[model samples]
Target: MNNPTNSKNPADVVVIGAGIVGLAHAALAVGRGLTVTVIERDDRAVGASIRNFGHCCITAQSGELYDLAQSSRGHWLYFAERAGFWASEAGALVVARNDVELQVLRELAGRREAGQVTVLRAEETTAQLRTAQGTPDPAILGGAMLRDDLRVDPRTTVGKLAAWLQEQGVDFLWRTSAVGFDDGAVHTNRGTVYGRRTIVCVGHDVDYLFPSVSKEHIVERCTLQMSRAAQPAGLTLGPAVLTATSMLRYDAFTEMPSAIELSRTVDSGLQAIGANVMFTQHPDGSLILGDSHTYQHTAAPFLSENTTDLINAEIGALLGMPLEITERWQGIYASSPNGPLLVKEVQPGVTAVSVTSGVGMTVSFGLAERTLNSLFESVHSHRGSS
Candidate 1:
């Protein structure tokens, strides 16, 4: 048995947090031939990794962020094939409930590149999905569009990925909370361990790890509501759904002017309906729907129904057809102020990284690898300078 405490640093690199982003970093560090050790606060892999809808979006993703998202999606598919990973290529559909949403579709269409997102007219969208119906009110002037997004079971995916990492010889420590640390060592609840360098990835719980940086860094925790339903297979509508409210809020559609306006231009009908649905499926055959964003410096107790009611309305607005309700749950993700993400050194050897924004399940792997590279590269550069 190896003792990090005894060795004063048994691992060359120590990563805190075992969430998808942290695990991705562990995997890439292992691949880079570094003696890697991972520490997690929870006994089991939890956090946003297992709590999200698991929609791997690509099309309509704007700026350099698309590159990482594209690469991450590839990694998911690779793991699926290897681990007999359960997944569905059900695709996605963005429904425009108003003229603003329709404008968003047209803008996304004009900008779509290899990401595989496409804009479809009302008839075209109906032709593709065969489920969407009823013409929009002339005042609404909305339609549905197509996006090549994949949905996966975060619960299943995180577990399978954990298994794969162990198979590949990556070291792990569960229920090990890190109280404090810098580059030379990572001090956790289990004991004080050493490493040549360290990376902090506390997610929305950054306040616990890097208290000093938490004040300056624009990282905050966002709590959201989610629910599952026994919607018919035909009710899936063939793809995922991002409502106009979502189109307005999410950059993938809003990066373009028209999409932004549609997002901003609200209709009382939708407001009355509380439309903010982003629909995707799970391997368990349950539909994943929701989300309302509420940020805080500290974690909040799992309570409140306003977000749930609003999310359900969003779900209902898109999947208006009849469906059976199954379960309700809550989740939290890290939200960065803007830009792709920032991974920089807080001190000489201590590095901090957070992709709290963009709900990056779409790019966790690639982002992890990239973050790992920066950490080690800094170590190398430091050595060369010394």
Candidate 2:
């Protein structure tokens, strides 16, 4: 909904890509009184940023990413209020259906500082789920209630944020492609746009402008298949839900002692295919569910019915009921075996950054703030020397 004609003026920062990363950079720059122009190839953001579960899985993150997620949590709330979007502080309910999974939760709880995580007995978890109109499988041994996560409706969050940014005076150039960049300008299909600094947050399309860096980092595309179901009548899923399979996938839980045993208990096929089940509810009472990860240099744009069926079966076991699926889709994000994120100076006064770990919505705000601060400091230092 932003007017492209209004974006002809030069800006302090020109951000390429209108996904969450670019939008985060523009928001932070504008907040610091810098004029910003954002360019997107699509008329609107239609990428991993919008296709995700809108989960800021704070409790499951580890190391630097964990800190980033914690810092980003406040921004999620702040933007939700300013952008007029739905944001929930509802954490995560990680259900453990067996003793091995319960042991993993117990080990994780023991390692963390007090009060950060709470382990609930099977009866307690069932009672809480029942209160929320969820029917937990009787086989569920217990659950870990991670109190720090957040969720938003992915389908609408970015659109709302982009609109809010326009209201804050940020310019957007829709359907524009950046072919290249120089010292302080971007060469696009429209024309050359000048800026004091340039930041590229193009998500998985790394080869578009920086093929060398993308190749050097071994960046590949990771595809995931997801589905949504009409919420059962009168049911409110109080928190984002995860099954025991999630324990083997999230580093925070996987690094724990009992995780090995839990992993051994899981099906080898699911493990080999990197399938994990997660559920987050939207305000409209629809449950967004997913997903299986498949990585390659170029991901095939096909959604496997087998993967969908596996996801449904896994979640059905936890929910104790069959869900009426309403929609199905697939999303692709950048992935790297080298690191969780890629941040490098692709050229003078231009930085290229990508969230290769599918945590863009989780850590983008904090990461952007840090990136902008460092960039501004470098520019100031150069000016002082000159």
Each prediction's RMSD to truth: 5.1, 4.3
TM-score for every candidate vs. truth?
0.85, 0.93
Please, what is the whole-model Cα lDDT of each candidate in the order they appear? Answer: 0.66, 0.84
User: Tens digits of per-residue lDDT for model 2 on 254-366?
Assistant: 89977889777886766766887888888888889988999998889888888898888777667667788999998899999988898999999899989988789999887
Candidate 1 residue-wise lDDT at 368 = 70
Q: Pick the candidate with the highest TM-score.
A: 2
Error of 2 at 196 (Å): 0.9
After TM-score superposition, the amount by which residue 335's alpha carbon in candidate 1 deviates from its true location, in angstroms, is: 1.9
Model 1 TM-score, all chains together: 0.85
Q: Model 2 misses residue 84 by how many Å?
A: 1.3
